[model samples]
Target: MGDGRRGSIWSIPEGQGRGSRPAYSRAQITGAAIRIADADGLDAASMRRIAADLGTGAMSLYRYVPSRDDLIELMIDHVLLEADVPERPTGDWRADLTLIAENTRRMWLRHPWLAGLQRPRATFGPNRMRLLEFAFGALDVGFPIDEIFILLDMLNGYVERVVRGEIEWAREMRQSGMTPQRWMTESAPYVRELLGTGRYPMFERIVMDARLPHMSAEEQFRYGLDRVLDCIAAARP
Candidate 1:
């Protein structure tokens, strides 16, 4: 004997049952939630708001989405459809990883709320599964599975770190009119004073000799990504 409860939204069939067709769909609800989140951040995408956006009662949405957690998972997966990766990885692992990295960055920028999701969940929605296959399969060289996991983590970690910084910087600019160029210009006197002391050799070198700080965000990201890929190349058998 088994209970008739469904554990996950993914497991539940859409509009399941032979009654009159449902008034709204999970896709419609999820899409509305995404649009709200994109415009006003994640917390604004409440069930009530989403329902109002669809011109229905909030209670009616529960019949389709069940719960807020389920809705969030759906939203997360729905945006990943924009990642637009190929059906299969090319044999050139570096090129494949580069494609993944670039697409992932663009996706996160388009959905800055994604950077706010701190906890990792085991939700394997279809788009997520496809991306996981492409990323894991890209590193399907001679490395062991565990090593492949580590390598992918390393690559994703780098991308996440850089993209998070970019997201926050953009937010800061919007909120306070702060940008790298403006900050550099405003802080140049203090930076020069510090450099004049010559006490911090590495700091002075970074100030004087580093091209990274002077480059645009895109240039810096590409340069660092190339270095990371080079490291992966060095580790290869």
Candidate 2:
């Protein structure tokens, strides 16, 4: 969220550069690629589709992006740069973490494909490094750099785990030709029937709560962040 810099480990290789400018200078191409991923999911966002959107041949884009993986990484980081992380939240770590979590949730919602595109193998893009620096800075908790990285990775892994579950559920629902709500409805009768045996009244009572499943990711993110921070606080002398 800071001023643009070559923060990515995957900066275009020298051969791929065009006299200092990136071989591809058109923001339109990148924007179209992002849109394709957003509208149809990352799998639908091929280099060919992006080129078609730009009215160019797919081969031409190769000068800019050597591979589909690069394009996907760039797309994800580009959209990440668009997220608004407010000024540092002073020393209030709780409020700062909440802001970070909400910003992350909003970014994921804006580009659902991002949750799918990211992988453990992918190198740290510049935007990602900035975000990491941001998280550490906001924490301002005096943890060692390695611990900070581990903590951030844990937080990130948790969010991605949740998002990936949602993505898979959405994909399965689409494949089954049923909305999630419909699938839930169809399963409810069987579930209620199972509960009628009286072996799980506590579970039934929990399920009956009006607020179940209504909590937003932002809320969950904040809840998890605070819980982890509380643990850290407790561990302190």
Candidate 3:
């Protein structure tokens, strides 16, 4: 991610050392940029917009942050710190993983813009590395490091996909002024017709007989997590 000369943006100071006194700090610029991204999203968090927020020229921002990509890397690492991973693994591997996954899910939902960022090939920033360490350490089971990495990837991928879908649906609901109840009411006729055709028997049976209302969102999430963990346990050699 860095060419050594420019180095990781974290190594750079927030202020121009040549100056008598640096007014704006890197933390200020990064915080402003994060607010912009949080409010409007990654596309809205440009150098120009961030500069406007900081009351400086966009080009001057380069003195503190190297590039937009670098800024985003900073943002990602910054937010990852919010995840309160356990100080040590709970020793129960499945319990530890479930706690970690739930923490991760809450983090994504907290920063809705994160799902939309065009992240680079992960550069292993400080907090990112901390997260990896926590995940690996939590796997108290005797799996090798390589397989542990794969398990982390699978869990991360699942959370990413699930949270993105959840965010997208919420965004659409807000933009379209359509509540789930309203959507069900509006689409009831079409949905009923489709189901009546018996094209999907199992889906219809579940809708009618499985008592989905009893399954809350958290329950649904845990159900999937438990199944995935079960599979992971089975995969152990």
TM-score of each: 0.94, 0.74, 0.86
What lDDT tens digits, residue by residue, belong to model 1 across residues 116-138?
A: 88943557899989989998898
Higher-ranked by lDDT: 2 or 3: 3
**1 or 3, which is superior by TM-score?**
1
Model 1 root mean square deviation, Cα atoms: 2.8
Please provide, for model 2 over 1-237, each residue's C-alpha lDDT reduced to its tens digit, 9 standing for 90 to 100.
112344442754535544565445435666888889889987888878988888888877766666665666677667767655554446776666566666766677677777675463445776666765677886667777777667667666766676666667667776887765677788988888878998988878766874535565446556666777676566433
Would you list the clashing residue pairs of candidate 1?
Answer: none
User: In candidate 3, which residue ranges exceed 4 Å CA deviation?
Assistant: 1-7, 11-17, 118-121, 211-214
Candidate 3 differs from the real structure by a C-alpha RMSD in angstroms, to one decimal, of 3.0
Candidate 1 achieves a global lDDT of: 0.88
Candidate 2 residue spans exceeding 4 A from truth: 1-9, 13-23, 86-89, 118-122, 168-185, 208-211, 214-229, 235-237
Model 3 is weakest, by summed lDDT over 10 consecutive residues, at 1-10
Give the candidate number with the greatest lDDT: 1
Clashes of 3: 0
